[model samples]
Target: MFVKSEYQKKLVHVKDVLSMINSGDHVVSGLAGAEPKAILSELHTAADSLRDVSIITCLPMGNYEFFGNPQYKDSFLMEGWFYSGFMRKLHANKNITFIPNHLHFASTKRLDYKVPRIYMGNCSPVDAHGYVSLGLSAVYEKDMIEKADLVILEVNPNVPRTFGDTLLHYSKVDYFVEADYQMPELPVTEPNEKDKLIGKHIAELIEDGSTIQLGIGGIPNAVAQALKTKKNLGIHTEMFTDGMVDLVECGAVNNSMKTIHPEKMIAAFALGSKKLYDFINDNPSVEIKKGTYVNDPYVIGQNHKMVSINTSIEVDLTGQCCSESIGVRQISGTGGQADTAIGAQLSEDGKSFIALYSTAMIKDKTTGEIIEKSKIVPMLTPGAIVSLSRNDVDYVVTEYGAVSLRGTSVRERVKRLISIAHPKFREELQKEADALMIW
Candidate 1:
């Protein structure tokens, strides 16, 4: 509760802050939409001068030009909970540390660590009281700012001033830099016929009064497209995209039937097209809170009829979901998928869905034959991370069918899962399931 100064503030370029950092210091950038691109660029440029600097954060958006380049390979190290395009490129580099945890817990745990410096990012200008809003990403920034020895501010006027717990007292910031650039805009990839069909089938599982938790990419976008006709649909999700705009306009996402946040759209954060960002700007109907509240199992269960839809890289016949890894390789982290799944199960009339395409490839790896490969595996490869266990999954949706496996015995659940798997892989999956004596 420190009082901020309305004194004539001068903007300090990011290079000034970069020069002040010493070797072996821990610096964490604000997560998601609140990422300070200007500061990050400056740090990248100064990588040669700085050494052994550890950066801990979640999926950082936009172009990452100098993350693990050879010129500064030993300079900066990344400790991340999830993988993005940049992380994929640096997968082989052992310098990048991968920590597996739910997104909600990561946001909360970031505070307990020894933070030498914290970067405070914002989109709006200083108010009368000299407070700045955290824009689309108020989600874990408050904690980062509170526990740091030095607080650096990126004052971007173009960042939207979103509502809810998003304000920061200017006095907390040790350095100020004016950076007015448009936030990163996520592009829309149109859905194909197969994707549209999958979306249609998934849409059928959603009722009028269901509150939803969904992830990103074409599948979630396609599913949102099919939900435009549904009535009173509420969104209590981790992140929203451009697809949600249509549902809101059609009066479908009225949030009237939601038992929690009745008139407000509750989300941890958002990353989407420019229009989507502009739509949420100062819009009171939307409440952009921290992930701690939005992704909490207890908060999500307060709503009646909650339906959590998440994607997976693969699912085993025994119902293990590997959303964060490909076999033994760690591709991402166990994010809010487990949080929402468990939350949906605890709701009074809720259902959790693990949806993905039947096949990722159309070639047989062992037989050297042209055949469809199943994303639904007989068993998860060794050391694969299971974000959602069999007991937590309520339903499994594919283009073929939807199987409910919550209360069913292990043998019965295995049979139901194999039945919904791709037709080409059914026989192989059945043989494998039988070998496990599951049926």
Candidate 2:
């Protein structure tokens, strides 16, 4: 192990160390809440002195000067793996580009194209053995740090000391900067009536002792809240959240019956409140593995009775799911929706669910009036990207009801799908289905 004095020798001012970045350098930062705020701020400040500096990021939680200021476009480019609200707002800018990828293969595939010159992220304080934890996110930080030419880290005490593949030796890092900023918190979204209804429908399908995968949002949160009555439920998910913590505390998730990684909650990354951070800090039951292993379908299938519940923007009559986009506009990238959905189906008694509200309020362009429109349309809007294919979907759930599509013909699918659609739209949908000869 490297000595603490040797590691301290490499510590330098954030601005001075970032000044090492040359023009045309490809840089990658720690994603989400794990992003090194101090170092990235310096990079943004130094952008005027550099040109063609491409920064690859995903689910950026903070609004930094680099992304917010249009003047820096000539010097800095933002390439996103997943579009957060900030990235979506910057979509019209020429310097902003979205990279399409599956969450499981995101880091590995990006490195294959072009290895980053710099990999920097925030980490927990160094331990007595000269080891530091990558804090909350281990999604791709470890992979990027291993491939980058220079590795930098910001030491933050607020970051929780998570276990699994998140530990790094001081010797592997080339530079360190002190950062005392608080980790960004994703507040828990209370489940609405519709969300709870949908949750009840999905929860009915989940069996006791089932290992579960949940995405982030009101729907997933509602599902977690609804599952409090379940016994011995386990978690094998991509992103951990506050809701999962509630399950554990409620005595609902003991992980006792999990077929893989028994008695442990396995996840790739986590984002939530300070309460969630405190729960994972040095907790023996939680393991933060890499995305490559955690989100892999084969690994997810190893857990018997796996149930993956993911939200979607819309679904067509054929069961094609459009979760990431609305027509040509990219709202978000394809994360682990397909990964865990397919993986859950591969489990011996697993089930995959796509949940969404039956109706969405949209403003009419011509009339300028807000109207409730059916999300379960006769056909998806033109140019919508299918995040999950028809064959891969097993169950479709709406606040109205839940329908199974597996081994069903197109006619049966159309009828079953229409049954769960908002009642006002069912008549029109049935008429369209009749015209299209779907039934």
Candidate 3:
């Protein structure tokens, strides 16, 4: 079904198109699990050839070594939606730009117009009938091709043929580059001693038949691992990794009680192992959609028993959630954490939880060196973004225990939050709490 057209008939290396890119060109790529490595490799080669080649990406995974060097600073610039391990270095570098947007808007906002001239993406190899799948990032790339001036489709045999908004006709792709490579599998952080204890406590709070929204990280993954025996659990999350696979296989997550989408798992995106990708392939049980719909606080509130469990870098005695930044540094962004937090609060039987360790890294006077410090700051740094306001937060979970903050007095909120603070700093936190007289 390869039509013989000028742009469609070309059998060129992925690098060749990347080499043709010039300044003022906005280049978009499939971020996270579906990154086109071959095209990226070629783009690196053309770093010096192009000027002001603005590359836009979201939740991108894999090595971004080329973007780090100062030599290519003038040639190419990068922007990220969520900071991955590779893009974390960009926060320190001035050349790179950072945009705080939800995952759903990552592709929709750019693809609805001609801002991005070139679209770099990966897809499952054409099937016997010549159809390719968007693999892990269908929600973003589907709209990219519709709007981009040029679409470079990498046909990787290893990309899973996932279902829901994944199918791409051969005629849609402008250039096809044949490549076979394995999708990257990020190793899940093994639950540490603290994580396991926290996980166990969180697991006990989750009841059977509850609709769950979990954030990414070791604690969330551990919490999922601890709930394998709980029955009839439903997932209505913004994103999920390999941890949910085991729960689904073991019949722990049956999606039976969810009022929104019965018997189907709903999410904005998927990022995990090949098995998770393959499991979603052509699977009618999954619906991948935009963040406006998937992460809408109002829409999530429609579901029954919505349990949103998100993390935080720190929490103030006043119950403010700081998830986007660490003190002054912008390490992450306000993702669907607040969206789901509010959703859980609005659900008739729902509960929103901000879970975190209650300490920061600091120096000890006795030891003459820094050690685990308290993250329960008395007050947020001036101008710090309060992602989850006091009205939005319902529960704060720590290894110490869960503190319910909904409808609690300001004084009570401080008392409850400080109660769970690290022992070394509890008295100091209490002293600050008393001085403020936050009641």
Candidate 4:
């Protein structure tokens, strides 16, 4: 048989892919937008025949039956590297657990402990050369694919053909399932007033020719808006979003002045609208490298004037930031925040900024009342995970203003942090600080 014909024999129906599952097998899937829909959506069908099947994923975009149904508890358990709304709402089921790691080592650490039995990744169709592009992400998918005992590619036409370390030969795959499903897209809305002000403050701190790392959020979207006026900015971000597309199209990010990976936009994954997927397709200037290299602090620091812009949920007076959780409950993973923050700080003139609104409007789960709480506090909530340490947080930006705490004492951080807090909470925060002798 010709090579194409030989590889063609691997193509099977989606149900056939499900039959490959075995009891006590561990499975890994691609990140956010690259999540396989048809296969994962029906994995529960095979659960009755299998037991102790653990699935590892990051920011899964779908409410799959395996995750949405509690009946699969004994059959399947999902371990997510990061949590979004889809998995966060299902955390109470007890089948979903969180894995804490920097983006660079998310898969590396896991493999050292347990190598997965299977890897399922979304990919573009095989080309004439029998190569398939690991669309949407190479974050950990590429790594897991190399280690898994069985490799399955869910080939979808909607998947953008991206370049970089994402290409895989057909000979390496055990099976191929032709799946027709819409590619997942993360909705990008316009930033609100508070986010815009925070963006302005962060933009002021970034230099003209700096390389920047940005992730998803209103603040990052706002930062991209405010940065349109900058010149020669380069991207070394973890997620490639529509905001980066805006910057590039507007002539703001030309990648000409980057010290590392100059003239190319490097990211570990792509998660945005169809526009973003279209922009990266067959695009040579953009590279979807694996998370290990893309999010490595040392690699990110090689870029001159590296700036890391991220958002947080809450922060204490000591500059300790909790970006991924609410008290003991895990809200998100400690993805690239710690990675890029420390990496940017390692650069010669790099800066890291953690931006958030001074207060958050939270609906009381018990009383059904809307309560506004200050994000800057004298101390963190009990059991809050410190996603970014005090020593790693260089700049803290709120709508009110920005403060630098790189080498500040606890007392100074307390004062500076309070000064930028929501006005209604300032007096209360100061009183609490005094009572605790935080100063």
TM-score against truth, every candidate: 0.94, 0.98, 0.90, 0.98
lDDT of prediction 2: 0.91
Per-residue lDDT of candidate 1, residues 1-439 (tens digit): 3234432354567777788677898877776678888877767787777788887767877546557564566888877767777786676665677867787777667656565465546556777767777887756677677777877778888878788777776776777788878888878878776668777888898899899877777788788888888999998988876777778988889889999889898888888888988889878988888888888899999999998989888898778898888767787778799999999988999988888888886555678778657888877868888988877888888888788988888788878988888898889888888887766
How many residue pairs in model 4 have overlapping backbones?
0
For model 2, the superposed segments whose C-alpha errors exceed 4 Å read none
**Clash pairs of candidate 3?**
32-60, 162-281, 162-282, 163-281, 163-282, 359-375, 360-373, 363-370
Query: What's the C-alpha lDDT at position 92 in model 3?
Result: 62
Among these predictions, the greatest lDDT belongs to: 4
- Model 2 lowest lDDT segment of ten: 39-48
> What C-alpha lDDT, on a 0 to 100 scale, does residue 175 get in candidate 3?
81
**What is the C-alpha lDDT profile of model 4 across 48-70, one tens digit per residue?**
89899989989998999897889
Candidate 1 stretches with Cα past 4 Å from truth are 1-10, 362-371
What's the best-to-worst order under lDDT? Answer: 4, 2, 1, 3
Query: Higher TM-score: candidate 1 or 3?
Result: 1
- Clash-forming residue pairs, model 1: 123-159
Per model, state how many residue pairs clash: 1, 0, 8, 0
